[model samples]
Target: MSVNIMLYKITLVVYIAATILFLIDVLLRRTSLGNYARGTLLIGLLVHTATLATRYAEVGQTPVANLHEALSFFAWMLIGSYLLIDLRYRLDSLGVMVCPLAVIMLLAGGVIFYEVPHQNPMLDSWWFPVHVTLAFAGYAVFTLAFLVGIMYLLQERMLKTKSFSGLYYRLPSLDILDIINYRCLSFGFPLMTMAIITGAVWANQAWGGYWRWDPKETSALVTWFLYAALLHGRLNVGWRGRRAAIVAIIGFIFLIFSLFGVNLMLSDEHSFDAFKSLR
Candidate 1:
């Protein structure tokens, strides 16, 4: 009924249209549909931007205060990152996977309209949005890498097993996938590092200490270390192909645990209150 929800619905409709175009392109081998899908998705992103902006204006602060907000924001980050990567690589095939994932995230978030009574004063600072944006951006980049990794492995398996299929033809080459995975790693590490640094600074301001042994903090650190090791091996030790893809996939799992497992199943400063508590 509200303008924010209405804009969100419009964004979802646009995303679904783009996704349908992409699926048709994949199924019917219509190259023009891919370009149309990209344009449609870009429009959807603009609408999504409006949705978030309206929500922030309505809330008088950052909009990511609950599951509904966080999921929507995460979906936005994911789609934005995918678009950025696709821009560089011209990866039309990836849209098939990413668009559906974005739709699912939006739908799941839409299903839960949990809202808090009052905004947490800790989230009043600019650091809340900055840190969360950087962290979610990092998560988005790694997710793309993981998706590409899966594609790489699947392609490799098909080649080895000599079981050619339509999906194999649709997916990018293993080399391209691996190169993009490395690029994602290179981009995401810095974002994750910045997120941690900003989080520490914010923590110092809010909690009177930079380092807390809280569950979220510890899990983020662990996930960061995992990425660090992966990057180190990649740059210096020359890990590539199956090794890199497999490890990157594992890293994504760790990231999921760090981002969701700690916040949802476990309790901490970043538990999200399941969209509860102004205290």
Candidate 2:
């Protein structure tokens, strides 16, 4: 009914259309359609950005206080990151993998329309937006890394078997994918680290403690360590290709648990229902 909601729906439809175009391009080996897919994706990104801007205008805060908002913001970050990568690397084929992910996140957001009350004082803190934005941005890039890792494995398998299917020809080279994976890790790791540090500072400011060892916090730490080890292995032990890909995949799994699983399954300061009084 509202303009923001209408824009959100339009963005979702555009994303779905873009995803279909990308899928067809990949499956039919029609590389010429790549431009059309990218154009559609850009349209969706623009619409989605407008939707977020409208929501922020209404709320006067980061539009991520509830699950729906969080998911939508995460999806936006994912698509934005993918577009940057596509621009830099000319990897339009990756859109086939990424567009569907954005669609799913948007769909999940659409499923839950109950607006969370904005009375929580945490929304007033300057650190809230910074922390959540950086954290989800990190998650978004890590997700891209995960998808690239999967593609790397599939491409590697095809090469090993010497089977040159359409997929084999369509996907980028393992070297290119590996480079993307490492670059994503390099970008995401620091964001995650800063998120944790900001989170701790916010927590201490709000709850009078720097470390509560909440389930969400612990899981976040685990995720950080997983990526840290991967980075260490890459820089020191020369982990590359399959080893690096596997680590990235596994790290993303842990990240999913940290982001959604902990919030859903455990009661913590971070849980949606567990808001604390600023007093």
Error of 1 at 277 (Å): 8.1
lDDT of 1 at 114: 36
List where candidate 2 sits over 4 angstroms from the true fold: 114-116, 273-279
Question: Residue-wise lDDT of candidate 1 within 68-128, one digit each (tens)?
Answer: 8888898899999989988888788889999999999899888876353266889899899
Full-model lDDT, candidate 1: 0.88
Candidate 2 lDDT over residue span 99-118, tens digit each: 99999999988987735446
The reply for model 1, stretches above 4 Å from the true place, is 114-117, 275-279
Each candidate's clash count: 0, 0
Candidate 1 structure, TM-score to reference: 0.96
Error of 2 at 158 (Å): 1.4
